[model samples]
Target chain A: MTDTEPRKESVSCPMDFILRMLMGPWTTYILYNLKTHGPQRFGELKRRVAGISAKMLTERLRTLEGAGLLRRDYEATIPPKVTYSLTKRGHELDGVLGSLAEVGARWEAEDAAARSQRAAESKSAELRAAE
Target chain B: MTDTEPRKESVSCPMDFILRMLMGPWTTYILYNLKTHGPQRFGELKRRVAGISAKMLTERLRTLEGAGLLRRDYEATIPPKVTYSLTKRGHELDGVLGSLAEVGARWEAEDAAARSQRAAESKSAELRAAE
Candidate 1:
């Protein structure tokens, strides 16, 4: 039982590896942006993924590229332009991200409801204490 | 626009923070086990979550407890026994986790199909090169 937790060194189970790759803070946002908006340059991706930093976005892009999930194209010019888009392999993950997005929406609703309930309960508790 | 990234300090968007909370490698597994198996002891949790070690499991449990996602009940006995289960807030996350699990299954199937397709294409290319 090698249960002591291994490093993220090339996950052996293919699907697990793939899922973990997209498990980053900005991963789903980035992937969804690519799927919905098509190919985008580096700064375009940064803008679309909400809270991603330049360094983190760059690191994430490199990881995705290394894992064969995305393809990068560079155009030669005075200032080089780099564009990234999903590869065939990455496109396969869209269905997965789609499913997650649906769940995320539900969680948003439920969490809101829970917070309201708590607020109500808190107010009642305060009234009782005052009485 | 605060273009610079902030640390994961106190996630502002409740959903974003919560999602990030459950985004750890072994998180879903731990929660799923709790949902399916009901409240269990520390050792049981350790066994159920495939790759979690004692130290990491302790850390995660403490984090979840601190976040109000789980409740810890300690039975005062000859030896200590600690049991953990989901809070109402954590139960609310079930819908989200369920959605993710469905997507995870889809990704598994798609990865298999894609690998087969690639293997076939590679063989075809090899044969063409030989010719």
Candidate 2:
């Protein structure tokens, strides 16, 4: 088969498409902000997303809009105010995002526990060396 | 705050961590295969994932293993067989994956419909021009 064949198959596979969409850097962060804080302006997103550059934020918003996950509304006001909000398809991701949040919380807890365990083991080894 | 501060905050956010992990290429493909087909050997995965390089697959597996999302088992058989399977935490992603699949399917259907609609519009425009 041609190289395009596998990519075509990926489009047909729902999991693959979703995974690819989320694979983009800042995609989920933007989505999370919209979900948690509701519609936000460009500057507001840039500030709340934490550490994302304006250029990257703009690119991510465009990508999200293209994917039909979010919408950009430009108000006909002075300076043309723009706000970003989730589309119905984006809101449909709530279940998935919620599940990810649950798993993420577990990962954090496990990571902390592992770190403490390692520290304890190292401390004990030091004690043994002294003894 | 320092640049590192936001990075530190990202570690605490479960959604961010999960998104980062899933962001890696071949991660979801490998996970999808394992989830659908049960445990898989290295060779099996390489063949089944479709278009992934051996090096990339190995790297993705290592990343998944490090994240506690999958377990790599070494079987002491002739030629030394290694199998990979999802861990409890990895399996915990079922809900998220399921939701993603649902959305993905909807996306594909919408995309196909849009393509056909465009095609029909083009055809009518051509007819009008000919008239």
Candidate 3:
């Protein structure tokens, strides 16, 4: 059966669906790869998405595809051939994923400072508690 | 003591910190109001940020402030005047949020269709199992 049927959320918050879809494990990264590469095979995707396990990649791909943010096509010929690409709707999310990538880069650059600050605060709070 | 002591994360993944920060419960909406309204008081903030309680707002505010995304100032006057504003670092996150908002709009528009698709797929899978 075709998976592009339509999926919606009945979460408490109206925006929960979007948040859940984007913030789920490994979603942002998957979308980022699709946005950058246009379309990719399963092996290519697994390699491109660093730190993702094959099982995890497959799960996330299924999740995103179910959400209509991705399209997965299966080829009857060859060794389990499958290709993943973004739908028109999915491509529309490119700008959003681009912004997320930019945010990720900025945070990576500043992670050190943020860490040191957190450490100092934790230490100070502990000292206060001891006193 | 100053709350904006520069809190950071030491998550296993580099991008995890930003994702954790932005994908937190109320971060996007809090930042959204700050972006739209410039600076606002505690009550104003609580009211403007829908579905957020006083305690959650306080916690989220503290978290964002610690992350250097917000500045919270308290006045020693009779009425306990407090105001929150985005710092340069925080305001810099606006473009990222603008894109998120755009993505959110898209999802909200198509949520019904997505939901129907998911339901159909689930029902079909169940039928195949029954057969």
Candidate 4:
């Protein structure tokens, strides 16, 4: 929809809907991990995500599944194996994820460089004060 | 950095860094609004964003400014005009935002279609029961 269209105060606006989908904590990260590493078991995903509580992971997974973004496969094996992977629809986020990564890398590097420069400047100022 | 590279437990990872930047509430919305509408004074922006409180808008605007993603221009006058626009760094998010909008619009349309079909199916089932 064009911007000229009267903006709705609800998620009916395309941008608003997508933002709500992706805005949850650890949502995009979960998608990225699955996309990059392929299907993963619950434990494996939790480890890969790092710092995500088991409960949070389960909740996010269910949300994604409910939205039809990912698939959950079940196996009635010895330990009852279950795996999560991006569905065809979830994979559709490849471009958006890629862009985020590329831009993130670039910005992160720039921020680091700026930090280093600031540190060096402060150190020199300290030296000048001592003299 | 390649995913094969060992992941850090911090925002050093490219995806993590960018996600942290964008994951805040109403952040992308604010950026999207600025990009589409060009420079806008604070009052106009508060209106266009829809449902954003003046306090939240001010906070998000400050955060964006702090990150160097947007510029705030001030005109010293009776009303104290202040305009906000995306900086070069913020403009870099154009591709990311565009992808989200496209994906969101497509999904929204699909969702609408699915809802309609479900309604039709339920109606048919009800008619069958009546017969």
- Per residue, candidate 1 scores C-alpha lDDT tens digits across B1-131 of 17634653332233344556676776666777788889989999997775678999988888888877889999999799999999886786666556455555666677699999999999999999999
Candidate 4 clash pair list: none
* Ranking of predictions according to lDDT: 2, 4, 3, 1
- Give the range where candidate 4 chain A is weakest over 10 consecutive residues by summed lDDT: A4-13
lDDT of 2 at B56: 97
TM-score of 2: 0.83
TM agreement with the true structure for every prediction: 0.65, 0.83, 0.62, 0.83
Candidate 4's residue-wise lDDT over A1-131, tens digit each?
Answer: 47743545552336666666677778877987898789999999999888889999999999999989999999999999999999988998888878888997888889999999999999999999999
Give the residue spans of candidate 3 off by over 4 A. A1-20, A47-59, A76-79, A103-131, B1-17, B77-79, B106-131
Residue pairs with colliding backbones in model 1 are none
Worst 10 residues of 2 chain B by lDDT: B4-13
Tell me the lDDT of model 1 at B29: 66
What's the residue-level lDDT of A45 in candidate 2?
A: 89
lDDT per residue as tens, model 3, A34-97: 7767799999988877767999999889988987888999998868889999998788766656
Q: Between candidates 1 and 2, which one is better according to DockQ?
A: 2
Cα distance off (Å), candidate 2, residue B80: 1.8
Number of the top-ranking candidate, with lDDT as the measure = 2
Error of 3 at A26 (Å): 0.8
* Candidate 1 error regions (>4 Å): A1-19, A28-39, A47-53, A65-73, A85-131, B1-14, B121-131
- Arrange candidates by TM-score, descending: 2, 4, 1, 3
